[model samples]
Structures are given as structure tokens and as C-alpha cells.
Target: MAAAVAPTDQGPLAGLRIVESTAFIAAPLATMSLAALGAEVIRLDPSEGGLDHQRWPLSQEGASLYWTMLNRGKKSVTLDLRTEEGREAAARLVCEGDGIFVTNLPARGALAPEALLDRRQDVIVVTLDGSPDGATAIDYTVHAACGAAQMAGPAGLDSPVNNAVPFWDVIAGRTLAMGLLAAELERRRTGRGQHVALSLSDIAMETMANVGILPEAELSGEARPRQENWVYGSFGRDFETRCGRRFMLATVTGKQWRALLSATGLGTAMDRIGEAFGAPLDDDAERFRARHAIAALVQDWAGARDLTQIADAFAGTSVCWSPYRDAAQLLAEDARASPRNPMFARQAHPGVPPVLTPRTPLRLSAHPRLAAARAPDLGADTASVLGPLDTAGKEADP
Candidate 1:
């Protein structure tokens, strides 16, 4: 390839380089973030591509949309690390440039910290694992272990309900990105590399800690109760509109509650319902305890009007509400057209239609705009990458 185009202004991570040897979401997403911020990210996959290359939700041509979305704007090199030559090439790739390697692969045997550090002492090695002790796990298993599945469904359901979103994987990916950036900054200051390790379980625990869920349960000896379609500890729920559209509404503050009542024209009805319970619906706790009564009034009002009518009513109010939309609806309205979407870049692949992908959410005035490029096909850059590595190895030979 001709010299990579040099942008007039590079992003905040302009001088950084990250070598990624991981499949799936967490590790790939972490490096992708760095790549978006202008880091040179070179990803390594097995000779036939990693498991993620075959992930479902593919295009008509059987290309992995999941893999393409996660690995966007990164160079891809495929190698069979089981071979001695492949191992040498992998080591050379790790030791090249800024010498930062991120992977979720096994911590022992091949491609471990010891092996990479042996190749380059100043190499920054970051590994994300299922547990701190190197146990293997994926998002679903980690999410299940974190207690989220148990509290997911409606009240009175005995079975666990797994969420559609891979919550732990998303969090762990961001966590890994945070660690990589921090290590980069420290490496710049100290001129020394470090090994950053993160576990999916640990990330889940941190998330619980941040939300105060574990502490609340420990102190009160009360497990979180399922409140399907309702905001936990609050008076919010999903109601069907006259047009058969489901909408979620929440009011966290007194002002919001008053506005919601006004928006629905239900203040008087709420007052009457509150009187039936001999309780004033003036606080969150009261409304929460009497949520059934409150929801009845809301349902009656909301059910009598179409989504458009309800949306018009909410336009000038402080009521927090949105109509439930499926994937197609969201893609048509929010993802494709909404100004709120930060990842709005459109990239065209050779045989594929243009795709709209979200970029890193960080918005920095000093940083240059991120590059918009499609994910490379398997081993697309292998010759360009390995040719130079081979030349360097021969030149350094005695």
C-alpha cells in the first residue's frame, strides 16, 4: 500500500499505536476506540479469521456485520501462531512501533505477557479475562454470574431472564479502553511499559458497586425485586397508547411529575386516586408504593391517545417519555437521522452498501475528527505488514 494518508490534523491519540490480538467484543471494541482517536491499531486474527468473523447477523454475502462494525478503521493481519514463523511474526508485530499489545486470549502459553515482554521490555500488555485468575468466560456467562439475569423479569417469575443486550461485555470493553488509554499516558510519562489486567467479573462488580446495588442489598438484606418495564425504586412503567404503540414514561422530580400529570391531563384523577389510598402522591416513595394505582390513571389517559398526540402533549413539558421502537424504527428515526447519534459516519465497502457506524463518543475540541474507514477484509494487510517485518528481521540477523 502507498503511504497511509496523513491527515492535516491527527486525532488526540495521533502518536499512539496498539496491536490487538483478540476476537469478539470487549478487546476489539477497546482497541477500536483507540483507533478512532487516531491510534494506529493493527489487529491479528487466526489464519481462517477468529470466531467473531463468523458471528451471525451477516449480510447477503455472508460477511459478518458484527465483526465489521467492531473492527472498523483497523488494519487486520491473519497468522497461524502455532507455526514458528507465525510466532516470530506475531512477536515482531508486538515489538513494533509503540509496542502496546491488547488481547483477551489466554494469559499463559503463547501470546502471554511474559512472551511479549521478552520480545520488548517496554511493551505495554493489557489483557481482559473472565476472572482475575485466568478462567475463561463470555458475556452471557459473566452477565449471569453478576446477578443481572435474576432481576430482569417481571415480579413473580421464578426463572432468570437474560437481557438482549450484552451489558457486561459493553462495560468491560469501555473499561479496557480506559485502562489502555491510562497505560499509554503513563508510558509517555515514565518511558516504561506496564501490564494492565481486567476481568469481566471484576468489571461487573465495579458496575454494581458504582450503582450501590450490592451495598444496598447487603445493608437492607433485601434483594432487588423485578419491576418489568418500571423504573426500579420509582413510579415509571410502560403503557400502551391508543394506536397500539407502547411508550415508557418516567418522572424523577416533583416538577417532572407535575409536568407529566399536566401532559396527560391527569392531575385531578391522580389526586382522586391518591385519596382512595389515604396517601398523598407527593413523593417518589409514596408514588412507588402506590404505583399500581398511579399506573392505572396513566394507562387510562395514555391509552386514550395515540403516540403522536401524547408526543405533542409532552413537547412543551418536562415529562421524560419515549415511544417503544423496534430495531427498524430506531434505525430509521434515531440511528440514521437523529442529531443525537455521535457515531453517524457512513463508510462504503467495495461490494457492500454504505454502513452507518458509531464512532467513539468522546468529543474533544483539540482533537482532530476521527477517520471513517470500513473494516478490512481478512488478512488484507498481512503482506504489507509482514513484508516489512521480514525485512527488518533479516537486516538484524548476524
Candidate 2:
């Protein structure tokens, strides 16, 4: 209630303010990014708290690191929007706020219209929905039904496997931030407010646009099975090297393939190794792996090795050596130069950096991208938020 800290140092969207009426990932993240960019973001949550207040993947003492991570430096207001009093309080706040984000979707019989749009004419209203248009599904359900989980990998002996990570969250977070920023940018230009809506399903589909629509693009609905770590026409697949030191996983391109051959002690002339590893069949996966097997033989292939080493080794290489990193590992560095997160820091652990997912990848130089207030703590500033309501409350208390 005293001094509200701006989330980041970016000045792309300076002087912008947003109100969050979201429950979980998508909506909150959208607003969080806005706050990170120096926008005054006030999150409206339920007084009772949501599922995230005490969910899984906890710390040793059962602390919801999940909640802490997502809501690191955000202010929260626990007003009951379902009640008339609560609605009025929120309406008043939204009417005055520059931006408002909600988890409610838009469509046939969906949005509450005037109820949530208290400031329809004054502020930016961003919504996060559950599904795309007429359909709906949760994160896991969507991932399972959509073919992402199916194509994750081949079974050792039985059924297929699913990716362990919550890939949809990452994708949806990205989509939500992008949508919110887009809306904010437009508002800045027009000097008029607008509503921006997005759904987890929509975000998920967009994230998998290349693969989800691959079947449709090819004129066939028969989707491709899990390729695991292999892509078509790409030889020299990821394999374990000898000495069990680290894994050599990368997206080998044509030029990179030549380098790999030389790096692994193979000769410059391709014809020389044809008899031993077979001829390079252009983009043949089998031939590439065969030729690349020599390097794999010495590379520590299991996932046990630190993924960082793999990424570090390919820092400036032509090889699209895209190694898979866990959510925690990626945010290890401070704000990066390419659309970085200067606001993200270890507010909880001091010097220990908190784990971050990823930024929206959208950049704005002139506009303050981050530098806003943290999410509130269950209407902690209710008196300040709804001062008129407080006056009314005092008058009605007999």
C-alpha cells in the first residue's frame, strides 16, 4: 500500500495501468507481463483463493512454489464479483483503470458484458478463455487429444508416451502476453480502449500450428505419430557420445552436417567414408545417423547430463542444435538483450533467481515494456481501491 514497485525497467508502455480479474496462468500472465513492463497492474482474485493457492509440485514444506513463481510480484484484491457489492466495487476500479484482464471468454452466452466491462469506453479489456470458439478442453485434455502428447515419443515396448512438461502453459502464456501487449499498443495509438480476447485452446493450436495443421496442409487428417527426437529428412539424429559426459542433441542442418563430420574426426571427402558409414543420401535420416553415429558413440546421450552444456556448446554454431531445456533451466539468466525480462528477479530468495518460463518474444523500444506494481494480496488495498464503497459500507453499518 505504500510504494508499489515497478516490475521491470523497460519504458515501452510507461504510464499504462491494467486490472486483472483472472484465476490462473493465461490471464494473470498477460497482466503480469504488462506489469513487468512498468504498467500499474492490480489483480482481482477471489477472497477464498483458487486451486493454485495449494496445488502440486510443492517445495519441501509444501509451499506452492507454483503460485509463488507465477505471482511473484503482483498485487491481489479478493473481491467477490458475484455479489452486487463486489461487482460495483470492481466496476468502479475497472472504470478508472487503464487496462483490465479477465479469464472469462467471449462468445454465445459467454461474456457478462456490462458486468465485467465497467469501463468499456475508457480502458483496455483483455479476456482469457478456456477453448477455441465452440470447443473446450483443459490443458492436459487438449494436449492429449491434439496429438502433441501422442507424438512425444515411441514406447519402449507398449503404448506411446506423453511429454512430461506442461507445454500448453508455456504456449498459452506466450499467446496471452502477446494479445495483451497488442491491445495495449493499439490503445496507445488510438487513445481509445478496446477488448482483446484469447483462449488456451487457441493458444495451444497456434503454438502447434506447424504440426497441428500439417495434416490439413498435406490434405490428410491422418496425423503423424510421435517423432520423439527425430524429424523427417534429417539424418545425424541426437545420440549419446562415449565417456557418458553429455548429450549431443541438435537440429543438424545441411551445412552443420558437414561440420559435424569434420568435428568428429571424419575426413573432408564424403566418398572416403561411404564404405564404412554408407553414402549420404542427401537428407536421409538413416544415412545421416549412420554417418553421425561416430560422434554419438562418444557423446554422453542420456538426459542426466546438464542440458546447459549442450546449449552452451552450440552457442554460435550453424547447427540448429536446439536442446530441450526444462522450464527452470531456461530462466537461469537475467534479462536478455533480445526482449529480456529486467523485472524478473529473486524477490523471494534474494540472490537466488526465481525460475521463469519465457517472455512473449515481442519487443518495444520506445514503449515501457515493464515497470509496474506487483499483484495485490486479496484486496489488501480495498479501502484505496473502492473508497466510495468503503464510505457506503460505513453509512450502511447502522
Candidate 3:
């Protein structure tokens, strides 16, 4: 049976239980989505708030705004995973919880799930790291080493650029959620569980989307200098504008390509634009360039209009698209964030009003729980979580 909550919760994922022993974006995002959909997610963060708390965009109470943004929709329990006692305590919670997502993106000082799962056999664990084969140094270091920092751009820039966005982590988070759901379904059927691992490098490589990138040669040969706005894995896609605001334009065929023809007066019906969905981009450079030119013209059309009007224009069509948005812009234009009818609950934490956190996105029709209470202070759950563990420790264990 699903875990109990008020039947009025909004999302279909009501009643599932999840725990997060994560460092950064990927794991947090995965668990947050689950929480949005009505899963009970207990976020076990590091004792000192890990590497991000005091870093940037400070809260009034001085916690990192970045930290607040990613941690919505969950309860927090801070513990020292480096110590044996802490590890044991965490494993106990995982056993009680249905699933856990772990991030070793900063491949250093993370609790190893392989070791933790050795102690708890039935709990599902999803491990996220930066490199495919081994541990990563950190988010930036791993991308630097894997040539992602260089490949993030075009070939002319003098140096590599840190991807300001968590592209790898975002998609990997979705993938981790998928893996966990699949495992959860399997566990329900078989009364058994499995480990799911995702590497940030593998994810970055998978998302490169440029047709001309040669990873094997690029990694071993010259550290390819960075290039801005260049893609490597796919051919017929590029950025643009509809009436004025920026947009992404992706086309699949000469037919869908015709949509672009009508939208932007460039390219021909005779253009060889076969988008065999999984075809290699390097082999399709000519096709990409032909599309890129027309796409750039569409960018001009999009350059003058505001994002809202542009979005209204693309309401119907296979003109596959996206609008670039930062959090501030998102808060302003997104109907979900409207004060009159918000999709998420907004809260300013006890000491820091700058810690404006959004509630989980899941909306259940029947049993609707509001938002979780404010994030906890460090060791806030020590008594609650460790009490049973302490009593059991005094009793017995293998």
C-alpha cells in the first residue's frame, strides 16, 4: 500500500517514500521531484551544510540562496557521514526509508553507497558521480578533466568555461528518478532491490548535442580551446528568436523543416534535412550549418519580442522550442509562480526571509498536504532519528 497522506494531495506519486544523502543538484533534484509528487523525502545533508551554504547569493540569515533554491519540498536532517557512527545512523534511516539518492559529484568525502547498502539489503540506492569509470575530483574538476569545460563552447575562446548551469546534473537527476521508479516497481514485485549509478561525465557527453565533437581525439589530443554556442552531438538544431525573445529551434524533417521555412524565410524544400533521430552529428555537419543559418534568421525575428508574446506564438506546432530563463525571469513570467494562483507554496525561513523556497511541484487532487515546515537547523533531527538507533545499538547488530 502507498504511504499515508491526506487524499487531497495533488500528484500521482502520493505515498512513495524517499531519502536523500546528496551533495548537489542531481540527487536533490531527483528527490525534490519525488516530494513534489507526494513522496515523503527526508534530506540528510552534511553537518556544516556541505560546500554550498555560505558560498554565494547569501540569505538574510546568511545561508546560501543556492542551497535554499534546490532544497524545497523536503525535511532536512544533518549528520556527519564521515564518522562510523554517522554512517551507521544513516544506513538505519535508509533501511526504514524506501529509497535514497547519493551524490559524489564532488567525488571526495562522500559516503559510499556500496558500503552502506552492504549493511541494508532491501533499500534502493542511486549513486551519482562525475566520471563514468571512477571518482571525480569535483564538479568543475571533473568537467575540466573530461574536456567538458572546453567542449561547452565553440573552438575560438582562449580558455575553458565553467558551465554556469547544472546541465549534467539536471538530466541525470531525471534519470536517477527514472531508475529509482523502475527499481521501486521491481522491488514491489520481487521484494528485492538494486543499485543505480550515473556519472556526470557520461551525462555531459550524452547531452553534448553537437554534430562535430570527437570526444576520443579531443580528450587525448590538444586540450581543445573553448568555443561559445557550439554543439557537438547533433546536427539540425540551434538557438533563435520567434518575434523578439530568444528561443530554441529543433527540426526533425524536411516536413517539420518546412515549418521553419514558413516561420523564417530561408532554406528550401529541396534541402537535404533528414533527422534520423539517433544519427551522428559529425556526419551531418553540412545539414546542421544549413539549418543553423536559417535558425539565426529566426533568432532575428525573436530578438525584438518579449518572451511572453513569443511563447504565445509557438503554442501549436512541431517547431520544437524552448525559451531561456533565469530564476528571476522565471518567477516573473511563469504562471505557476503567480501570487494569485501559485502551483507551489512559498516560504521565508525563520531567520532569513531571503531564503525564499518554493514548495514541491506535485499537485494531488484528493489528499493535498501543503508545504513542508522550514528547513531544520543542523543536528535538528539527531534526537528523533538517533533515538531508535541508540537504543538498537545498545541491543544488537551484525
Candidate 4:
């Protein structure tokens, strides 16, 4: 909006424009993802900021790192939607922008999908709600309701263990982006636009169904017991090295299972245990059934060696394993998390110090990936985006 700066890297989504009224995770993430792919995303907020403006994981200067990261590569505009003038201005912007509108906020009155579509018949409106019934819910609530939380913790634990990450919200964000693209494609083909609606709870439930959780629960009339760190239907779990560093090892394929045995020098021991149990350890089901015995031997082998020795042994092998590390350790040790990875770059945002920011993870063979950009200051693009609105909320003549 600020004079339309020339793009250095035009991604596959170049020229696609999106106007968003959103907050928190899913909607913001969806727009940000589109922005990374070269869409011009104009994000609308209240004058003070939206609900997530002050959300946690703040920088030392009290800037919301979460908000900053999610809204990167987007133009920020502020409007007081509670007023009739503000609502009219917002509706005008949505109708004028490449006919695409996205929001997780309530779409009603002037900004409703019906109203926007009436203004421009080809408008593609994407809306995400907590549930189909319009009940309030977030990632944590959806995860808990979908029975995932109950199956997440230690095997013997009495209570449900909630994951720290908001996986459902993340999934919903990507899903919304996909839906928007699909709608856009349809609009292009038929010259008609439609509304794309999604619910966070539906995303969680459908994912559970897709992963066989719902059917298993229905057929067995029971919930899956907590599995701790073990990979389901395979040989995998955590083990501690001699230096007390922990690593997860998983053998999902026969090659990986054989490699695990070979690397740990436990082939004979595993064979003996299989013979005692009257099952071959090579079979996936058998491996899962005899996981305790297999894990014990692997743990003992790992406990006798340091992490470096374990890494050396597994290097260039089919043994799938990784050393556990915290966030600080990931930044310090892992090359993938650093700027060495093509997906990441050190960039400065408005109020925070320069930090590692990421462009879209998706790689397109046809187009170059756009570089990540910092989020704009609140209302930074309001004048350029909306021009000078009159007292009646109409765009004034230039």
C-alpha cells in the first residue's frame, strides 16, 4: 500500500491480493502463509490493535513475538469496526481488493460474506469459526474435546496431558489457505465466487477420523491408552545416552528395524527374545508387541555410549534417530533451525531485534520464493490502503 514497492522475488502467488480481518492463530497464520507466497495481504485491526496484539511470548521490549511472526509480510491497517463509518470503510476495502476476503472474526452487518458477495459477485470469502454451531473454542479446547489430549501423556498417568503446541490451530490455518486457493481457482474457472467456511473442531475431528482414531474408538468401544513417547504400530521410544542426553529412536520400516539391531549390536539378543515370545521381531506387529524387550536392549546399548558415539554409529544408516534438544539448544546446534537452512533468514521487525524469520516452507519449481519481510507498525498502511476517507467513510477524491 505504501507506494507498492517492487518485488525482488515474485513467488507463485504474485498479484493475488487478500484483505483479512482476523485475530489469534488460524486466520492470521493463513494470511501470513499467503503473504509469504507473494500475495499482498492487508490485515485490518482496531485502533489499539486486535485481540492477539498483546499476546504472550513477548520480546524484551514487550513486543508480541507471536503476533509479529504470524503477521509478517502483511500491511497493517487499523479501523474501529464498532462504528458505522469504520464498517463501511472495511466493506469497501474488501470489495475492492482482488475480491478475496478472509477472517476468523465475526462476519456480520456490513462485513458479512453475504454483504461482500452482494457488492462483488466474484468475491471469495473464507471464514473460520470455532465450531459449526458457533460455539467458542480454541486449539486447546478442540484437542481436548477430540480425545487427543487423553491419549497424549505417560501410559500410567491418571490425567490427560495437553500438548504445549496448538497443533489444531496450525492445521486449521493451512486448511483455510487451501480452501481459499481452491475457491479462487473455482472463481477463475467459472467467474463466480462463494464462501469457504471452516470450523476448528471439525478440523480436529476429521483429522482424528483420518488417522483411524474415531473408527478404533467406535469398534473397540474404548479409548487408546496413553503411549508416552512410543511410536504406534512400530518400534520407537526415547533412550538416554551415557552423557545423559536423550534421543528418540524409531524403526518403522524393515530396513530401519534391521539397522537398529545392527547398530546397537542387539541382533542376537532380539532374536532370543523373539524366540522366547514365540514371535519374530522383524514383523511390525511383533516389534510393537515386544517393544519393551527391544527398547530395554537398545536403551542399555545407548546408555553405554555417548550421544556422539550414537550419532557416529547411526550416521549414513537407515536407523532413524534424533537427539532431543530444547529451543536454545536447537538454535545453537541444529543447522536446519538456523539461517543455513534456505527457509530461514535473519530479519528485523518493527519493535523487536532482528531474529530469524522464515518464508513459506513450500518450494515451487517454477517461481522463486519471496524473502521474508517484517510486520508493519500498527496502522502503518492505513492512509495508503484506504486513501483519505471522508467524514461519511467514503474514499475522498484524489
The prediction achieving the highest TM-score against the true structure is: 4
> Cα miss at 60, model 3 (Å)?
3.2
Give the per-residue lDDT digits (tens) of candidate 1, residues 142-224.
Answer: 77877778887778899898768777888889889899888878877887787899988898878887898888888999878
Better of 2 and 4 by TM-score: 4
What ranges in model 1 sit over 4 Å off?
1-9, 107-110, 272-282, 335-342
Clashing pairs in 4: none
User: What is the Cα-based lDDT of residue 397 in candidate 2?
Assistant: 100
lDDT score at residue 140, model 3, on the 0-100 scale: 64
lDDT of each model, Cα atoms only?
0.80, 0.54, 0.61, 0.89
Ranking by TM-score: 4, 1, 2, 3
TM-score of each: 0.91, 0.71, 0.66, 0.94
RMSD to the hidden true structure, all candidates: 4.2, 6.8, 6.8, 4.0
lDDT top scorer: 4
- Report how far residue 2 has shifted in candidate 4, in Å: 36
lDDT of 3 by residue, 1-398 (tens): 65566546445666676766676677777877777666767777676777655667776666776666666656777877667776667777767555454554332222466655565665677877767667653556656665667665555565778867766677777888888898888888987767788776776566553433455556777544443454332234445443444555656555555555565444442243333323322233544554454444556666656666666666675566676677898777666555445444456653457323555554544545555435545546667766776787778866
Tens-digit lDDT track of model 2 for 1-398? 54444455544555666666665565566556655555666666667766576566576655565565566445666777666666666665666455454555331211244444443654656666677565666677667666566666653424545556667766776677777677667777887666676667766666567654554545775766545555544553455423233333443455775555444433444444455566653445645455455333424233333555544445566645544335454444423422255533323321223443333244454443433233334557665766765676688897
When summed lDDT is taken over every stretch of 10 residues in candidate 4, the lowest stretch is: 388-397
Ranking by lDDT: 4, 1, 3, 2
Off by over 4 Å in 3: 1-6, 10-17, 45-47, 96-118, 132-135, 145-155, 206-345, 350-374, 391-398
Worst 10 residues of 2 by lDDT: 343-352
